[model samples]
Target: MAVDDFNRADSNDLGVNWTESDYSTPNSLRILNNRLRMGEANGIAHYNGTFADDQYVEATVTGMQFGDGQTGIAVRVSGSQGGFSAYAAILWPVSGRVRLYKYVSAWIVADAQVELANVPYTLLTDGVLQFSTVKIAAIGATIKVYIDSVEVISVSDNSIASGNPGLIARSSYWVELDDWTGQSLSYDITADAVTNGSITPAGVTSVVGGGSQMYAITPDSGYGIFDVLIDSVSVGAVSSYNFTNVAEAHTISATFGPLMGQRALLKIRPENCGHITINDNSPQYWFQHGDNIVIEPVPDAVYALKLYVSDFPDAALTTGEPDSLPDEFHSCIVDFACYALSMKLKKWKQAAKYYNIYVKNLTQRRKDYIDRKAEKRAIHQIPNNIKYGGTRQ
Candidate 1:
């Protein structure tokens, strides 16, 4: 990384570290009042050092006053001062436009090989003088432009692959550039996970050259983290991992296994009662060794069991037998049954009285069912990606 705050004695010569566009015109670009000021209408200057192929250049540009031209930062600058090939992130104050360009020979628009991307930007406030930090990054085949810490343009082009970092003032010389910084960019870190587990940020993620990234591993229900692998090497059963000062591409994966304590325990008995039908299918059941029973079909994996039945029982329950319906809904069933009994006895007046009571009870029961289902939908809703299927409640 290289940084220059331009805190130097006021001089027409920009020192040995910089290469100016015009060597004959010394005063066109100079350091004044600790700031690098571009006095000429279309002056360009670049640092002498060449950074990595994937690098960035950033500087704080202060517009001394409103101007009609553009000022920008450039990356991957190659060739001499006149025939330089580079990518630039430019800001136009008058039109509030930020543009990314690929230049081949000069700062003129006709000299640009391609207009990569552009976005609107507000460079100044109504009254206050505005200072915006401009950044231009060229990593691999991609180029990203940022103004005031906000990304304005990102495009992929492999035109120019290497060069030095620099500053540009195309007819916008009334600007002071400071806090210039240039550094190599970071690489992408791709993460993945298999069934029964997940890795946070489970996709391609970029990390700064000397920055850190932390990832959390979580296992699904009835499962435990079995192993974690970083760059295809086992890292044990870690719940989380951190990458410090990431400088290259990396890959991570996680695996899970069934939790032994939560495994499905089968304890079946002889089938004394009749078979139950589910969705019009009757699964066979039989007695096994010594009072042990096994059902014909069951899910191989751990899953929730949900049973849905008619609102009312098909037959009357025996004395002391519990009803499947909740206690509150039991009265409505009894009222409807009484109405049916009165009609069977050929008592018209009594049947009408019982039917009226049953209708009122049925209305209230229907309302209660709606309210109960709504409550379950709100509190016990399941995500679409869950492994097992079940009712809301």
Candidate 2:
């Protein structure tokens, strides 16, 4: 849904150099590639690869030079009917201060120009060495700008209703139209190495006994620490990143951590040296139960993974003699049992665990009644209103 925040760089994704133009009048207007380097008055650009009226446009430019007539990315771009703008400008003399400007159709829209002067290096140098990333995503009637991962401003209007994207070099200017970072990095997972991954709703489970009844999250197939934990407590704190069986994919295993007799929330963050950035800035999300989370790079790559769990809490029946048939006092089945039912209804997995004690008991009672009647008939027989007896001497 929205790339889950983290943007990973992969092979098959969009890139800067990403374009629009009029081929008939190549000189009148041109798109050298996927970029719009416009000249003349109020030249506009659009990056709607989908050509859709509403969408987000983000770009990353490195090595930008200061002291130019005008240099910035445009947004809320549409046709001659309606449009809007959310751009970052290197307004001469105002170097490090990020400024915002907006317009609706032909009307100027104002939001008390805001500036972010914190990251000084964010400024552009003498018509060179200026690097800045811009992003504009449509959120309702407004288009917002995020300069290098930071939200700067949002503008709302209905001018130039829809059109192509334009990276205007308004007035006298010279700038390196480089790759847009937002679209530059994109890739997908060709192979996954996570082996044996499971989660417990109530708590982790242990394969070994005589050790504090701790629960766990483990990658049973791999030989790494498989760093285990619940909530923030450390279950099995492995000190390395490369989890490999060297023979097959790695499996991470987790045993209950130092909970001191309490259930903890399970959180998983990948740390494989080549697999995870360790300090990945990408977005993260919680598990289906909102406990275990799977994170990936954002706006670039997507990965498909399934959560395979063993002891589903609701499906767990009491560990004792087979429960009495057709239990009356307790209408509710064991916790795991309920969960298994839910999974079945949703068609989530394939398991042989479909047992209804109520039905089994009913069948057994019916059979018992028939057996008693047959035994009595073998000893004696009754014919309608009369009794049948053995023949007399």
Candidate 3:
């Protein structure tokens, strides 16, 4: 029930719906001795309907009069007569190679050939009447080619999902095709995701045995893929996955988690001239640089400094921009500037007040960060109280 025969009374009466296109000349296809003969042109003869996802198309090359060209079976043919696309499993008798090619937009584009095999099959011996059976099987994203019932090439691609089946011949050649047939099978696909992310085509999809489907995972803001699981086995942190030649149902899931301790720029301005310290440690300080002030942490000072502290050594009363601090704590920059200005003016009482405010705001900022992290962990079902050293409780 899976095979369809192509040999009938004539080319038009081949018992299956079919259409042909001559890339070089018109009326290049004819029926001779109950076989489809392609005459001196590069073109394709496409079946006028779609095939199952998991299917195979095969034909026997009965006569190839020229050794310079190639002929083969075309599968998953899509588009119009002038510009169509399909995967071709071809035999080049001159080169003694069996190759898989993708025909697109009225041209046989180069380098798109998926190599299959190389064998001397006497396809162009002129009067020798040698023949070879070429078969192409599409199982999900996997494409496999067989010559004379022996597996030749197998490759994975999700490009052409399902399309019509056909025959193709290239350039100044006479090739005879007979005993063309096609068959189909069945399969299933499924998708899922863990917290903070979603998967496209988010449910089960039914397809033929050789068909393919592409799935993409999108993580929410501040989240990234932790891992991807296919049938309970890890496949690393990939955002996209393609299922091919699925013979049975499958479950694909992606897990996402918050990206830990993301940092942003924080600009700090010092108010007076004095040696400055951050979290009780001195930082690299600069006086002036093109109408701007720059202060950088000493090497390895980032780990020693407090998460919310943004102090730098005193240099000029102008603004100083520090790099790589969390964005949420940016408001504390003004408080620190005021505290430094108060200290420079020798206003001890005012300096103490602003410093206290800066400490309070910094503490609140840290608390907010921790609270947000705890909420994210709850949403992702991760344990919130897992102990850690330093400022990350």
Candidate 4:
């Protein structure tokens, strides 16, 4: 067995991409099942050969950001080859948050959520984390996952719809996970939220109350909407909105003008009440604790530009005069915000007769913000990859 199987000597981060060998870093050497004589990792360890079919791969990686770069072992993964759709090994530093992402066709989120043990800072004897394990169970359209010898999830959607499989890794960076088990698949519901009476993984809400209940489905793809009836009565009928029933991560926005008279597009989302630094970027509206942000690539809109918060949480969640710092005392507002959105989006009927789920719990202030933000842009159209101090590394 090749001790330097990853071929550390030829790995470097050219900013554009990493070499082929570095693409196959591992989370642990035990993945070899004592088959290979593995040693310390220099970070980059990729499968430098051609592609294959139905392969099981695993690895243990160390010294990587909580959510950056493919720091784990990869098997029969596919990328630029087809827009990065593989099971990356991510070990949350200091907390050992071991996880495997089946980045299917959607490059943003993993096929399903896999929670390993919390990674600790001590694993880095010298920026090298202790051996971790990542495994895969691929079965056509559906992909199952396992970590540390434990099965996690059996996704219902394609992990990465259509593409060849191979290893993946960022340039220069270092992360390793080993367990060269074939590959995995996940027939997961892409990040797109589908709540037209269906409880999907997007920001959801469920409210139940007296009389009849109403709901406003703010999808990641839509503007043309209609009034919703629970039993049968008039509740919230403002605009005839149009939305594409696909998959994607969505926010709370009001689409009023897409129908008839005075059509206006209004949006309401959370912003950080602190500095714009990395430290303050937590509690991002898009993702909740423990893999709540189940994002997906939704279909494009017709005759309209699909509005979305691209650099959100990263850019949207910021603190200023209106934003307040996070505290147990003031945490109720945050919970309220999440609950309000979820309930509104959920199949909940938690209001008096004839109340739209979108309007529940929202005070006058929330309404005002939604009204004002109607003209804001929600995408990151950066020309070229711009690099700052702490970019997407």
- Candidate 1 per-residue lDDT, tens place, 154-179, comes to 89998887788877666643556789
- Rate residue 59 of model 2 by lDDT: 53
10 residues in a row with least lDDT, candidate 1: 377-386
Off by over 4 Å in 4: 1-4, 7-10, 13-53, 62-70, 79-82, 100-131, 159-165, 169-174, 177-393
- Which is superior by lDDT, 1 or 4? 1
For residues 1-393, write the lDDT of model 2, one tens digit per residue: 011111334311223432322212222222333443333333434454433334444555533334434455554443431233333333322355444444344311123223322233345445454445666554335555666777766565443344334443344443334443222111111112234444322222222111122233333432222245323344333322232112111223343222122221223221110011113333322222223322222211222321211112222112342223234313323422443332222222211122223223322332343346543111110111111111101
Clashes of each: 0, 64, 11, 93
Error of 1 at 112 (Å): 4.4
What's each prediction's TM-score?
A: 0.49, 0.32, 0.44, 0.28
RMSD of 3: 16.5
**Which candidate model has the greater lDDT, 1 or 2?**
1
Best by lDDT: 1
Model 3 lDDT per residue over 1-393, tens place: 134343455643333466666566654555667787665456677676556766778877776665656667878777755677788887776656677777555564344344433445545454565446878887767888887788878888777787777777766666677788866656566788857989988887776675678898887865656678888898766778898756767888998765444221223222311222334555533322111222322211232223222222231233333344468766776776676554333234575566556555765564555466533211100011111111111
Residue-level lDDT of model 4, residues 1-393, one tens digit each, is 111233332223212222332213432122232222122222223344332233345554423543333344444355433244555444344444545555543333233323322333233445455545655544444444455577654554444433333344433333443323332221122221234222122344321111111233442323223333222332342222222321222233332212223121212322211111122234333321121122221222111111112222343523332333223213334434443332232212331111221212222233334445653322211011111111112
State the TM-score for model 3: 0.44
RMSD of 4: 25.7
Best-first order by TM-score: 1, 3, 2, 4
